[model samples]
Target: MSRPHILAVAKLVPLLLDQLHTAYVVHDRVHEASPEEFAKVASNIRAIVGGGESKVTRALMNQLLALELISIMGVGYAGVDVAAAVERDVPVTHTPGVLNDEVADLAIGLMLSIARRIPQADQYVRAGRWGKEGAMPLTRKVSGARLGIVGLGRIGQAIAKRAEAFGMSIAYTARSAKPDLTHTYYPTATALAEQVDFLIVITPGGAETRHLINAEVLAALGSKGYLINVARGSVVDEAALVEALKDGVIAGAALDVFEKEPHPSEALWTMDNVVLTPHIASATWQTRQAMADLAAGNLHAHFAGEKLLSPVPECN
Candidate 1:
């Protein structure tokens, strides 16, 4: 039998690509194909593989007449138009649990980076400023501080568990209170921010959560508090965050993701109180490989007439 033709929206890890090559004829990238070439093979494309940020727009999916699935290599799939996929009876799968620990680890890392001024201290030492200018200024303590988690989902819970090791008091704000959770619950983000020394954002990204952490939340966090975002960038208002950091509305912020990726706001780049990473919370080798395995397994399962390993909940 002929191999299924699949479109690769973004180049995946070599290991996953090797596995995919064994069962499918993979096209390199959608945009790379010539107009006539794409049209010729569009109807035969059975699936698409992408990272969390890949765009599987309605226009693109409409071209794939036989598109059976979209396999996302990471936990976040906000880039994929889930509504469009559901309308066409196509299911979407994402590697969720595999990267939870890595993301959570980064969340805690960001919290420490901000509160303790690790990045700034390192830069100070590297520049020989420590030798010339005496001791760096003291920074806030991380241990035993109040921690407010903005979204207590899987990754959020993981962050909470890690925070416990530091003896931090934990509180949370979610869409609705979780019955099993014993931590203090706040109905609103502003309410949660008001009482915590650190407010970590580990929420999912979507229209509902866009700018959920805005000026009001930042103001509530106060000048003594810090913000850590290991979740989607859109979940926090970048403009508000910049203003807060500049105006001392909040003490500092450490962010793994940004509203504009690979192009975070220029204002944040020079700010000493802010730390920025290029959306690499789940960039560790082990976690990325596990995520790749799960994503590939989901695609393989779909083609083999078996249950998908990790279909996004919305698909169900």
Candidate 2:
């Protein structure tokens, strides 16, 4: 039998690419191929694979008549047209649990980096300002602070667990309250923001949650509160966040993801209070390797007639 043809839509890690290439005939970025070129191999493609941020639009899926599964190497699949996949009876799978700890670790790290001004302090020392300028300015404390989490999913719960070690009083706002947990639950983001010292966004990204954190929520967080986002960039309004940071509507922001990605607002670059990362929450070698295994495992299982390892929530 011929090896199954798979389409890769995003730039994936070499480990995953190696695994896919070893087991299947893979086409890299067929979406960018000319129409005539795409038509040549589209009919033979049986699967699609990409990173979390890959765009698997309906138009692309429509071209692959043989597409059976979409294996996303990252936890977030907001860019994938899941609704259209469901309509076409194509299951979407993502590497989720493997990344929870890595992302949670980054969230806590960012919290400390921003609140304690760790990055700035490093710069202060590197520039030899600590000796000449006297001691650096005192920064906020993270221990025993009030924390509000938007979205109490597995990753959110992981972040909460980490915050607990710091003695943070945790509250959360989700689609609905999680009755099993003892933490306080607010009905809305604004309500949660009003009472917390740090508002961390971990919600899923999509149309439903686009700009869930806007000017009002930032206002509710107040000038003394901080914002940390380890979720999708679209979940928070970038424009409002820029204005808030500039105007001191909130104390500071530490972001792993951004609205445009690889490019955030130019206004944020010079702000001492804002700490930005190039979306490296799950970038660790161990976590990324695990994710690669899971993503490839899904494809292997599907072809082998075994059950999928981790289908996205909608598909499950």
lDDT minimum window of 10 residues, candidate 2: 29-38
Clashes of each: 0, 0
* Candidate 1, lDDT over the whole model: 0.92
Q: What does candidate 2's lDDT look like per residue over 77-164, in tens digits?
A: 9889999999999999999899999999999999999999999999999999988989998999999999999999999999999999
Estimate the TM-score of every prediction. Answer: 0.97, 0.98
Residues 177-260, model 1: lDDT tens digits? 998989999999999999999999988898899999999999999999999998888999999999999999999999998998
Full-model lDDT for every candidate = 0.92, 0.94
> In model 2, what are the clashing residue pairs, if there are any?
none
Query: How well does model 2 score by local distance difference test?
Result: 0.94
Candidate 2 error regions (>4 Å): none
> Candidate 2 versus the native: TM-score?
0.98
